[model samples]
Target: MLSVHTSPLHQPGTGDAGGMNVYMVQLSRALAELGVEVDLFTRCRGEARPRWADLGPGIRLRHLEAGPRAPLPKEDMPALVVPFSLALLKEERRYDLVHSHYWLSGQAGRIAAVGWRVPLVHTAHTLARVKNAALADGDTPEPPSRIRGEHQVVGSADRLIANSGDEARALRELYGADAGRTEIVRPGVDLRTFVPGRGRAAARAALGLPVDAFVPLYAGRIQPLKGPDVMVRAVAELLREAPELRRRTIVPVVGGNSGAGPRGDAWELARELGVSDVLRHFPPVPPAELARWYRAADVLMVPSRSESFGLVALEAQACGTPVLASAVGGLPTAVRDGLTGMLVHGNDPVEYARWLRWFAEHPQAGAVMGRAAVGHARSMSWQTAAARTLDVYRDVLCAERSGPGMNEAGATARSCLADASLLEGREGRNSTLAALLS
Candidate 1:
């Protein structure tokens, strides 16, 4: 598996790491559990990381030097693709297939698969065209080079994975990806860690949240694309309408600055709106800790401009916390309207504020929705996702063994009935360097 830009071992909710990081780590573990030997490759950023580390019983994480030995923005990643690809080709071990996450890795996979004479399966965690269309104000547009790169990857990949049916349709419409070559795989949350333990009161006490406070939690990177400013504005709007509620409401943002943007943008907005006192900020926590934050909240706010899939929403729901998310991308599918959570159309603060008020006004309704959320999240599992992904790998390899002429024809026929999506898992401890790296 080619991760290329970000390491799966990196902590999420900072920099360019988010759901895709979680998706890769969790899915790989699940695949490993199914007896698949996996090698995950990423560019080394000189964080004192080893050249190679064991991720699990069947998974190895390898770091290759590319570009400078430090973090560079995603915009700077295209230049490193050739170097990364060259590094990947140096591997003497043989593999049956190559799978890549995100476009940069997809580009490298395009080269590596050709070198290895293996099939390439690419998952575009977010498409340039899709994100450009839904970009928030002051957010930088995805470069044309990226769009062209995506088009190239889309055309060359032996098979494409989408996090939802919506994403599959986007691939078909935006990049002319063949429907026969596309597969929809829904992402899942880690149910074992994110369950509602000890209910809301204990969670509130553990997190230092007021027991009677109406908490609306934002738990991802604080970037413009995530619409954290919109969340701040909504809180201000909610406070303006009901001054009394301000005393009992707390908006905790558990993330850090990310993407190409200034630092403290959301917090600056909060200060400007005079709602800074109502806001609390915390750096990203581990998944087990994150679940506690979810359990403490009345509703989880996911106001993203464009999300391939909102894994945070599913995680929050798994913690028995209803989500109040923007009705964009896979969020509509993630949060069932009027059931698990409410989906507001557009990024208007007034609408989000209105929903926030409703949840604050009707606590019982929110609790009932939270109860329903747990069941909704339970239906999706990483084991099921891995089983389906293994099917794709087997199918691709099987087609390859049958010869090139029949590969496309066979893959196209079988993909018609495939149903697969995204999955989450536990983060593993880093392993010692292996003899292969030495």
Candidate 2:
């Protein structure tokens, strides 16, 4: 597994907690379960030498030094690719294939693939086009150049692994990637960690939340795109409609700091709206604590304007908590409308308030939904996701060795290019890389 300069396996909560971290950690473990030796290569964030640590018996984390030892934000990552690619090439001879995640990693992966003659596989967790549209005040979207670069990577990669069918459609429409080369692999959740049977009252008591009050929880980054403000308004509306509902509190348990600008403004907005007394905000808690919070919540609200895959929804469902999410991006795929949870229209406070009231009024229906949520969550597991990812790797490797018109080394090289391209872009450069690999 190749990540640009960061690995959730090594530093789980360093930056904005996104789905890619979940994907890397869980998928690598799953691959190991299938008797595959997995080595995750990522940049060292601090002043650390390139070293290897055992994540498990079969899984290892290899830190590579590239560019600065200090941490850089995701936006600044593209500039580090040339150096990272050079460092990656130096170590490329050891691996059979490299699977790259995110565009910056794909850029480095592409260079390394061509330089070292290895197979590259890529997965883009989120697309710039999708994200740019959902940007909030003070949040900067990826520039057009970066988006174009992503197009190149996708077009060039040997195989494109999309987290949802929606992303696949985007790939086809935006990057023109052939349907045959793209694989749909959903991100998985840890069922054991997020089990439904956990005691909500006990969990709430542990967190110092009032056990008698209905707790509405929103977990993840407190960014504008995530629409935490929408949640605040929704809760306010719920309280306004039924003044007695003040007994219930809405908790927005943010997973990461929202920097200095927009996040501060969001706080100000809460105060202005008069829900400051009810809104609870905090830095991301540990995974164990997060699970407890999920279990404790009467309902988990994910009002993100956009999401590649709703991992939070899955986690909440696993804890037998229903979710109220925006019906956009990969959210609808994870959240079954009226089944696991209710799906509301885009960040509309009125619609959200309606759902909140519906959940609050129909306690039996909510309980039924929670039970069904647990059952649905039980069917999807990190282990299953890992196995499927391993299958994708195996398929790429097999195709490299035995597919028509390519020798073992040549096929391997082609696969690597494909993987790298998946990280970079899906257009021109990616197509050129694919043609060269072929």
Candidate 3:
């Protein structure tokens, strides 16, 4: 697996790290549980680290020196793809199939796969065209060069993996991807860790939230794309439009800054709206701790302008917390409207504020939705996701073997899947390095 830009080992909710990091981490670990040897290659930045680090029983993260020995802005990643690919070629024929997460990795993976004569499996994670169309306020547009790169990847990859049916359709509609080559593989939640039934009162108290406060939590990277500003504005809108709701309402934003997500942007917006006292922000927390925040909230808010799979919503649901998300991208798939939560249309703060008010005004209804949310979450397990992904790997592998002129990479993929006995294992994990790097 190629994650050329960011390593799965990096902490999420920070610059250039979010769901994709979590997705890669969790998915790889699950694949490892299924007995698949996952050799994940990524860029080396920061302090000098080992070339390879054991992620799990069957997973290893290999750091390859590319650009600099420190993290660089994602905008500057394209120039390093070839260098990364060249570095990877030194390990020619070391593995079977090459799977890439995100476009940068796809570019690098494509070059290596062709050189090694192996098939390439690519997951866009989030497409440039898709993001550019739904860019948040003050967010920079995705460069045309990225669109060209993605177009090349879409055309060259043996298989395109989409986190949702919506994404699969976009691949066809946006990049003209072949439907036959597309795979719809949904992301999963950690049921054991994100389980429900925690005492909301104690959770709130532990998290420094008001014991009786109607908390609406927005957890994820605090960026324009994630719409942290929109969330702040909505809470303020809710309070200003209905001052009585302010009596016990509080909006807690959980996450770190990313891109132009200035550390104080959201806070300043809150202050300007004269709602700073009611709107709170915090650094990102580990999953175990985040579950408490999810359990304590009346509704988990996802105001993203666009999303590929909205993993945060699923995590919140797993904790018996209903989500109030923007009806964009895979958020509709994540939050089952009326059952798990409501999906407000457009980026209108007023629309989100309306749903927030409804949840605050009807606590019993929210609780009932939360119960249903748990059931929904439990159904989408990492075990199931892993098994499904293995099927894709196997199908691609076996198919390649059956065809003429197979390359070393194809042989590798086929050989890896040939372990019929290992296919029986259940699972999945994702993240830059944590989940994939697990």
Candidate 4:
């Protein structure tokens, strides 16, 4: 697996580390559980760490030296792709396929796959075109070079994995990805780690949150694209609509500064809106700790302007908390609208604030929704995702073995896939989820 831009070792919700980091780590571990030996390759950032380390029984993380020993911006990463690819090629071991996460890794995977004569499977995570189309106010657009690079990766990849049907359609419409090559492999949450272990009251007491407080949590990188400001604005607007609920409301913003540069201004926006007292900020926490925060909250706020998939939403739901997310990207699929959570149509603070008021006004309804969310989350898991991903890998390898004509290769791949009865059985429950949504 090629993950050139960010390391799985890094703590998520900080810098460039977000859902993609979680996706790689969880998926690799699940694949390993299925008896697949996995090697995760990333560009080395710190000099103190070893060259490679065993993540688990069958998973290994190898750090390849490419650029400076310190962290470099994503823009500088393109230059290091060739160096990274060269270092990756120096590996003595052989592999069946090269699976790359993100376009930066896709560039390196493109090189490594050719060098090893293997099929290249790429996951975009987030497309430049999709993000650029939904840029937040005063947010920088994705660079032209990135758009061009995505186009190249789309053309060269043997298979493309999308987090949702929305993402698959985006690939086909925006980047001209071949419909036959593109596959929907939903991302999954860690079911074991993120569960409603002791229910909401216990979680609230543990997290030091008031038992009766109306807590709407925002957990992700503090970036413009994530619409953290929109969350703050909604909080302010919510207070305006229901001033009596102010004493019982607490909004926890859990994450660190991230994006192109320093973008941690959610509190400043709150201060400007005169609702600083209602908001509490914290640095990013691990998955286990994050799950506690999710359990403590009444609802998770995923107000991202452009999210390929809202993994945080699923995590919150798994912890028995409903989500109040923007109806964009894969969030509609992640959140069940009125069933599990409410999906606001746009990034408008008024709509988000209205939902916040609804939760504050009808606390019992939120609890009922939270119960339904747990059941919704249980239907999707990392094990299910890994099983489906294994199917994709098998399909790709079979096609590669067939050689030349796609007509013969497609038939061969499908015929072989039919033999995997166990995987096919799970396929019935998740026609919408090719495996499970991340």
Candidate 5:
């Protein structure tokens, strides 16, 4: 079985709990269920010492200390990779393949693969081009060096795993990755946790919201990239056009925290628009609480300009809630227009207001769409995603070992063993490491 490393597996309060964290946790658990021995490596935060969680008989989460013992932002964690990789390589275990998530992990995976002579597979959840295009207003500043590093990782990876067809196309167009080297594998959601049920009253009661109110949900991180500002403006516009909506006790429940972003300013904007009474912003809730929010809401809104795969849309759909998302990035792949949900054109306030009003007047249509949304959600699961990822690993391994005069695979295995020998005398060597070291 292939061993994967998805370092920096999100702190509980971080805004990156959307797709990357969801993918890592669910995919690892699903792979284990398929009889694959999976070891998930992540950074140890604060006093949260390195510990192992036995997710299943075949899966184990091995926390590795990287950078500071405390949590660091994603953009600032690349320098910690060299030391982290060195520590990981010193361990005595031979993996058939090493799969990395995101560019930071890709860099470590590539170095580890070379040193260990294992095939490396990379999944860049979001590309530099998409991020830059979405955050072009100087609201979010990403380092130029990080962008260059991401480009290098994409070009050098043995195989690139794109989350959607659109992402695969972007890779081919922007990074010049060979079409043969790229594969499209959509992300999966946990249907069990996000299923439809009697959650509206329970969720609203817990949040101290009126049960009779019509709620519109915007779950995930609160940031400019997410375009919460646009959603606020749209809600303000909707209330202005139809005073009945305000009288009907309509509210926009935004789930997530500020997290060093424009969340404070977003609140200020809501006040400026005089829609503060209707905008209910709160810190992110647990998945169980989120499920209730999904059921409690009349609609889910995703106005993000860039998203590799919108997991929130899938989650909302699974809860039988219709969505209204931006027609950008992987959102188009996630939300079907007029089927699972409506697709608004841009971040324009007027356009969003129009859609909100239409849905308000056409409740029956929204309910029908929500039913279709649930059916659509059933087809996407973490088990399916894990199976697809395993196929990619198999294909890459086969290609690496195929053809005459290609002793590269054999040579690489020998080199990995040779490297393991140097750490034989190290303390605290486990059976897995000792056997490989010998």
Candidate 6:
């Protein structure tokens, strides 16, 4: 697995990290349980750390030195593609298939797959074309370079993995991706970690939140696309409409700022909208602790202008917390409207504010929705998602073994993957991984 630009080791809901980090970490662990060895490679951005480390029983994180040991903007990544691809080439020989997480890695993965004669699978966590179409206020449109890069990756990859049917359709319509190679694999949530019935009272006490407050939680990277400012504006609107609830209401916006959000900033927006008195800002917490926050919430607010998939909505639902999300991208699929949560259309603060007011008034209806949410979340799990993903990998490998897909170098890739399934009990050091780490 390639995750260039951002590392899975980084905390989600901060900086350049978000759902993709969680997706890679949770999916890798789930895949490991199914007896698949996963070596996730990303650009090294820190000093004093080894190039590779065993994350767990079957998962390893390998950092390749492609540039300076510091974070770089997404725009600067294009220049590092050759160096990143060269770094990947050193270890590409040992991999059966290359699965890249984002467009930056797709640049490297495409080169490595060709050099190693392995199948390449690319998952664009967010597409430039899709995002540019729904730019938030004071947000810049995605550059033409990124759109071109995505087109190249879409055309070059053996398989294009989309997190939702919505994403699959976008791939076809926006990038002209081959329908035959497109696969829809829903991103999974950690069921065991985000279990239901943690109790709202207990959660509030543990998290130091007001016990009587009607708390609406906004959790994720506080970016314009994520609409944290929209969340703030909605909270202000709700408070203004119902001043009586102001003393008993709290809007906890949890996450670090990024992109246009860093410039138009949520904290500044909250103050400008006169919601600072009722709003609480906190850094992103760990997953286990985040589940507690979800439990304590009257509802989770996802006002994202664009989302490829709504991982947090599922997470909040898994914690028996109803969500009020913008009906854009995968939010419609993540939330079962009138069942688990309410899906508001457009990026309007007024609509979201109306829903928040409704939840505050109808406590019984909110509880009923929360219970239904838990039931829906139970039916989806990381294990199930991993199993389905493994099926995709196996199908590709099997197709290659039988079909006339191999041409000289393809024979080597076929042999490597066909025998990999038999390596469940085996363990060894790969020279490339060892050298890079050392």
Clashes of each: 7, 24, 26, 3, 0, 0
Q: Over the full model, what C-alpha lDDT does candidate 6 score relative to the true structure? A: 0.83
Pairs clashing in candidate 5? none
Report lDDT (CA) for all predictions.
0.85, 0.75, 0.82, 0.86, 0.74, 0.83
Off by over 4 Å in 2: 10-14, 47-50, 258-264, 403-438
Residue 29 accuracy (lDDT) in model 1? 89
User: Per-residue lDDT for 226-292 in model 6, tens only?
Assistant: 9887898898899999999999998887778663235357778788888899888788899998899
Q: Report the error of model 6 at residue 372, Å.
A: 0.9
Candidate with better lDDT, 4 vs 5:
4
Query: Which portions of model 6 show Cα errors greater than 4 Å?
Result: 259-263, 403-438
Worst 10 residues of 5 by lDDT: 429-438
- Candidate 2 per-residue lDDT, tens place, 1-438, comes to 788756665323235556678778878887788788888788877745547788887988877877677767766777667666656655634777778888877776666666555566789888889888777666678798778778767865667888889889988887787787788887888876788654777887788888777778888876777887788888888888887887675565656644323353557777887888877776676667788888888899999888888898998998989999999888887888989899987678878988888887887788899999988888888887777777777777776667662233335554555554444443544455344423
Q: For candidate 5, lDDT tens digit of each residue in 1-438?
A: 222223335532245555677777788888888878887776665545446767668777666666777656666676676656666776677788778887777766766666677677888887877788778254766677667767766766778899899899989988887788788888888898998886557767776778767677778777778888888889999999988889664565545653444344668888899988887666666777778888888789898878898999999999989999998878888888889998987789889888888888887788898899999988988999889988988888887777342234334444555555544543523333333222
Tens-place lDDT per residue, model 3, 321-387, is 9999989888999899999999988889999999898998899999999999999999888888889
lDDT of 4 by residue, 93-134 (tens): 999998999998988776666556678889999999999999
Q: Give candidate 5's error at residue 227 in angstroms.
A: 0.6
What local lDDT does model 4 show for residue 221? Answer: 93
The TM-score of predicted model 4 comes to 0.92
Off by over 4 Å in 4: 405-438
Evaluated at residue 85, the lDDT of candidate 4 is 69
Model 4 poorest 10 in a row by lDDT: 429-438
- Candidate of highest lDDT: 4
| Candidate 4 root-mean-square deviation in Å | 9.0
lDDT of 6 at 30: 97
- All models, RMSD in angstroms: 8.1, 5.1, 7.7, 9.0, 5.0, 6.2
